[model samples]
Target chain A: MRIVLHIWRQKNGRSSGKMVRYELPDINSHMSFLEMLDVLNERLIEKGEDPVAFDHDCREGICGMCGFVINGTAHGPVRGTTVCQLHMRHFQDGEELYLEPWRAKAFPVIKDLMVDRGAFDRIIAAGGYVSVSTGSAPDGNAIPIPKDNAELSMDAAACIACGACVAACPNASAALFTAAKISHLALLPQGEPERHQRSLRMVAQANTEGFGACSNVGECEAVCPKKITLENIARMFRDYIGASWTRRPAGASRG
Target chain B: MASTFQRTLRFYEATIGKKALIAVTGAILVLYVVGHMIGNLQIYLGREALNAYAHKLHDLGPLLWLVRGFLLLAVVVHIVASIQLWLMNRAARPSRYVRQSWVKATFASRTMIVTGPILAAFIVYHVLHLTVGRFHPGFNHELDVYHNVVAGFRNVPTSVAYIVAMALLGYHVSHGAWSMFQSAGLHHPRYMPIVQKAAVALAIALFVGNISIPISILAGFIR
Candidate 1:
């Protein structure tokens, strides 16, 4: 198969970027998108030209490190599959593909296709965890969780922090990513103690990171690799609103 | 005192806070639209009934002014917050997509940014034409309420503009009403579909009810 690629190339974060074209005449149908990129980089290296720099690790798609917009759809045209897992067979022969990095104020382009997603880490650090004492692992049977609750928590927990939701959203909102984290923790008994505080902190951190507001467009859910639902965003909103009202002012009277 | 003010400012600065403001203010405006439609529907009941209703509303004195003031505030807040959100959304994505695709968003949701400003402009024209009798030559201030409405809609261009504005209003309210729930953090999976359906119904009802007046006059049914 022949593929014409117009890849975004940049020297650094401050450098101006442009789409540079390359032609690959013998692409295998069975090769993954990242593997196809590997072939292109090898060819570029042999030609003494700079190779496109994109982030990837654990090509199995679980690490969430691999992503770049292919033809404007996050993780390619197929839904619920990461870029690393997207095979070349899905595309037609003699296809012209337009590749670009995830565009967002928070996610600045580092090199060619790589963008800084550290803002997600900061949001998670804000309160994406439950506080527990350092001790031996708790007995699984000791704290019995409802079956439905456990499944719901696991479902929300499937988010890979890939930044696809932010990438696909027209507003560049991180509501889906932040909400997945909030809902995952809030659904469990262990995460109940600091639920209000977590919601408030995480939401405030996300806003501070320069993300836009969610308008219920559902684009995030559509492009989500894990198929995370927009319901988590609603749940996060519910928690955030509740927290705002019940949260006490510093040094205010407890009575 | 300063700290309290700062706290309030910070609350509104957050995206969620701004969204909640839009939702609450949007709800107020929706209520006013629905009430206005019901009141205007009395035009079908003949001149005495509709004009008597209008006079009765005016007879409320300061209470009427209070309601009007609140509605004015709501409209201002809703528009300001929405514009700010639109600008922020644009700033977030400095680079536009070369090939964009829509998956879940409807035409109404996508066109809100366009329809919103148009509706705002239409409101200005509507007020000038009907309320102040400034835009339309046929507008008569001394005439009864029913007579003023019928005479205003009797003009071809004015009636067409009114009908077009009402259609845009229908599109705006359809998405706005559904989105207000999510904005207000009132979205639940089981009930969201119901909310969306109700939004569509309300939008259709408002469109039909409001457009009926101008259509009736143009068809000589209201006269």
Candidate 2:
């Protein structure tokens, strides 16, 4: 199968990028999208040309390290599948594929199809974790969490911080990512102590990162490789609103 | 330690806070629209019944103004929050997608900005045309509400504009009615499907009900 790729290319973060075309006439249908890209890169290297740059740590898709917009979709056209797992068989012969990085103020393009998603790290740092004292790992059974809560928590925990939600969102909002983080913790007893503050701080951090507001658009859920739902976003909204009403000023009287 | 007022100010600064304001104000506006549509429906009950209903409303006097004042506040907040969030949303993506395509967003969901301003402009024209008689072709200042409505819809262009605006409102409400829940964090899996269904029904009902008047008038059924 022959595949024509119009891949965005850039020297660095500061340089302007453009779509550069690459034709691969001997492509195999069974090869993963990334594998095909590798073949193209090998050919480019043999010809002494610069290879297309992209991010990929684990081809298994669990690492959440690899992604770029494949023809406008965050993780290509296949739902719930990352670019690393997308097979060439899913596409037709001689298909033209347009690849570009996630376009968001919070996720600036680094080189070619790679973008800096450091804003997600800053959001996580704000309040994505429970403040447990450093010690041995606690027994999971001791928490006595409800079965539904545990399942919901795990569902929200599936987010990989891939920036796909922001990439796919019309407003480039990080609400889905921040919401998943907030919901993942807010559902359990271990996270109860700092739930309100967690929502407040993380949401504030996401805002500071210049992510847009969530308008109930389900584009994020549709393109998310992890299948994260909009329910997490709703949960974030619920928790944030609760925090606004109950949160107190720092050093305020406890009484 | 931040002051309580300062905390409140900070809360309003976040996108969620602004969205919550939009949701609350949107709810108020939705209620007003439903009530107004029901009131307008009285026109079909004949001139006396409709005119008497208008008289009864005006009879509230100070109480009416109070409601009006509250609705005005809702409108102001809804508009302000919408503009602020819209600007922030635009700035969030400085670079546009080269070939982006929406997957799950409905037409109504994507066109809120377009529908919203058109509705706002329609509201202004509506108020001036009927309430103050500024744009009414044959507005009666004698508190003859029935005559005013009939006269207003008598103009073919005015009736067409009214129909178009109602269609836009339908589109706006279709997304907004259910979307307000998500914004308010009131969305629950158990109730969301119901809310979405109700939103569609409400949007269609409002469009049909509101436009029925103009269409009927143009057809010489209400003259």
Two-chain DockQ for each candidate model: 0.59, 0.76
Task: Name the lDDT of candidate 1.
Answer: 0.90
lDDT score of residue A205 within candidate 2 = 92
Q: What lDDT score goes with residue A1 in model 2?
A: 99
Which 10-residue window in model 2 chain B sums to the lowest lDDT?
A: B1-10
lDDT of 1 by residue, A1-255 (tens): 999999989899998899999999999999999999999999999999999999999999788999989988889999999999999999999999999899999899999999999999999999999989999998878988899889989999999999999999999999999999999999999999889989899999988888888888888999899999988888898888777766666677462
Flag regions of model 2 displaced more than 4 Å.
Answer: A253-255, B1-3
The top-ranked prediction according to DockQ is: 2
**After best superposition, candidate 2 residue A179: deviation in angstroms?**
0.6
- lDDT tens per residue, model 2, A200-236: 9999999899899898878999999989888888889
Provide the TM-score of chain A alone for each candidate, in the order shown.
0.98, 0.97
User: How many angstroms is the interface RMSD of candidate 2?
Assistant: 1.3
